[model samples]
Target: MSHAPTTLQERPTPAPAVATTSLSSRTLPRWAPLGFAAVAIVLGVGLGLVAGWHSRIQWGLLSALFFVAISYTVTTAVENKRQAKDRLATSVVWVCFVLAVVPLASLTWTTLSRGAKVVDGYFLTHSMAGVLGTEPGGGVYHALVGTLEQVGIATAISAPIGLLTAVYLVEYGKGALARAVTFFVDVMTGIPSIVAGLFILSIMLMAELKPSGLMGSLALTILMIPVVVRSTEEMLKLVPNELREASLALGIPKWRTILKVVLPTAIGGITTGVMLAIARIAGETAPIMLLVFGSQLINTNPFEGAQSSLPFYIWEQYKIGSEASYDRAWGAALVLIAFVMILNLVARGIARWKAPKTGR
Candidate 1:
């Protein structure tokens, strides 16, 4: 006997509908920072006046604090906790940046204002040989010459040695000798400029040699070499290992590969480092004062006679304790700063020019 067939029934279960909500955080306007800054400034100025505070610095500090607080609060309400936290951090960073910049800007502005009074054709061209410190008619011509010659000599001596040392450390350094060299380089980096001067001075005394720009250059070379080495080492380390291996696979010698491939690849950074080192030593006064034995007259021969540098000139002028001397000191300071700035600009330009092209 067979059982009768039963009727089959089927039903499809439907998928859940997608649900959406209209409660997204509001986006901050692009001009929010500007608006916040404006409000902060107004409130800060008002509060400063009401509190009888005259210093603009205090006002600015208050404004920065207010901006940060307001930014955090507004972002929290309109956006979310994460956005608020981000805005808070951004505000703090902006405040720190402004704070750091303010003092530098003030110093530069003050220097430009005070130095402009004494920086002129006569001030730049004439020597202080016949002119007295209080007479206000002298120039930095001799000092300028000395600075150029000493720095040029120091750079010429330090750059090659520092670069080679850096190359050795990065390309082939191994074992205790490399470690010792690195340790000494680090130690040299921390030594005071004055200490370097003292070292040279001691050497000069022992050798019975008189103070001269040549001696100053020796001291500067000590202070400059470590900086150059460290910077160049870092640049060399940044070169890709694949490039070196590729050159080796092509039957090129290791030395030739390093010289032609690696050096070219990292030349821009190395040059930048060298220029920075030059700037670091250029404004040093202690070494120059001890070794160069500042001269009022133009000394064309750094090896033969006493010479003057910008820092030494500034020091001498400031020590005279006269209005004219003070002006001259300010002028020298401005010139020195300008020289350093010019060097930085040139370094950046060279780095950009020499940097390898990534795309055809």
Candidate 2:
């Protein structure tokens, strides 16, 4: 009866479990990378100066190395090992990107600076006809015209053949014949530009043909076809089989389906590939040298006589080794670069315009 007055004691509850670490606590601040880069640059420059290095390239390389090392070390100290490893990978990638870009920037700047001395309205509008290499009065008009003609002819010849060949490979390819064609295309892709020129030269010799823009066009066509085939084949392969099946189920002819449904779906990539092929052939110096036979006059006719192209013109000018010729060479080079860039830009535009529209 006396034990009835005993009371129960309250037990203490366990504390709620909390995380030991958080993303914000484990990661470096946003400004950390910039600060690390600044410190690395200063140290790299200081070391380069102390070591009596003159090349800015050396400074840049050293800075990159220091940046990667400093980032990894700092990250290790402030965070865990895993985050430090990730930061190290990111730093290396950034360094590689800068290294790749710096050379391109330097080359573009050098070309622009030297090329501007001679690239003017007169330079673009006139030709090297009746002008001495030692003098600075000629222009790239003749070369530009020849380049356009030859490349145009080559494109006209190669595009249809390559596109058709790619279609056959993707749509109806099934046999030893297809395999043989694929093998040859692959072989042609690696064939040297010089080899292509030599092959065309052999044909010219057999036919008693003279060197002209037409001859250059033939050589360029050889180089261009393989590129177009490879690129178009890849693009066509990317088209979904479901669309093809649906088209077939609708009782459409296979060729018509490919022409209407498959080609339109991949037209963007196809056009882009063709443009890339054109650009590849556009810069070929060997073919131009072996076939075009470089003209100094403004021979607008590509098939009749020797004609100049930008690559041949640049080579001829540089070989002259005069200040004026060097300027002309640089100017011609600048023009060629501009031409290629325009082609690429056009390709981008065409690709975007032709890309399949998807409803959201």
Candidate 3:
């Protein structure tokens, strides 16, 4: 038996190893996005040509469709169903983003191209008082002065009142009075800019007063107050109750706590909101047209004489029906856009600079 067992070891044989294939292990290459973009462009152009659609809009739509379809098909072939679906969703979001950006980019490009032709130093510094609409040497100096004064006055009138109202609503409001205030604020928010102008115009007429920058400012203030109040209320509401309670727990009065703890915390948002309101009212042509009465000469004193703003200037120039006037209108539009953009940037900067500190 021992001799037979020793010879039996060579009789057995081993099985071969089995290999596995998993779709999850497969993935698209790093260059896939670039390749997909190039292919989409070609397909989009071809489709546009074949369909006799000459517009960029049609080509863009086709390109987006092709990109999404091709991405899904390729991803599904290479990977599993779940990964392919994920890629499809991502492509859709990217396409939406591109669509949103294209119009804004086109607008900016068009404005810059047309505005650059007439925006010179001389155009910015001289008044159109002596020069005719057909002439090219006049500038926006008079309208610029009127706009600055009127807007400054409006801000001065609205900011304090709006802030106080917001503070009351957030910190001390209750019952019927609060509800009434809120209701009126909502109503005022929806009032037409032209209606605000008319309201002021009616009052001015009752007083036998003529159109002036002060009257324009009164209308702007009417429009701006609701915006400021709404924005400030939202900002103030964002201040944590815990912070207010902590101050009160230290024996501080509610008013003092609001001043010391709440206002500082929300100051950045408050300032930004105020600036936004000012920017909004800056381009209102209706109020300026009704109340300011479009001045051709510089009027530094807002309360005394007729005035003009950037918006009114643009309208006046366009209505003049001359090449020089049209050029000036475009230039004025560019300046107005630049001014608004600057305000927005400044607001963003202030918001970032004064954002709440969180130690990590």
Q: What TM-score do all the candidates reach, one by one?
A: 0.90, 0.92, 0.87
Distance from true position, residue 321, model 3, in Å? 2.7
Q: What is the C-alpha lDDT of each candidate?
A: 0.93, 0.93, 0.91
Point out where model 2 deviates above 4 Å. Answer: 1-24
Worst ten in a row by lDDT for model 1: 18-27
- How accurate locally is residue 34 in candidate 3, as Cα lDDT from 0 to 100? 72
Per-residue lDDT of candidate 2, residues 251-270 (tens digit): 99998999889998999989
Winning candidate number (TM-score): 2
Tens digits of per-residue lDDT for model 3, 47-114? 89998999988999999999999999998999868988999999999999999999999888888888
The residue pairs found clashing in candidate 2 are none
Model 3 lDDT at residue 355: 68
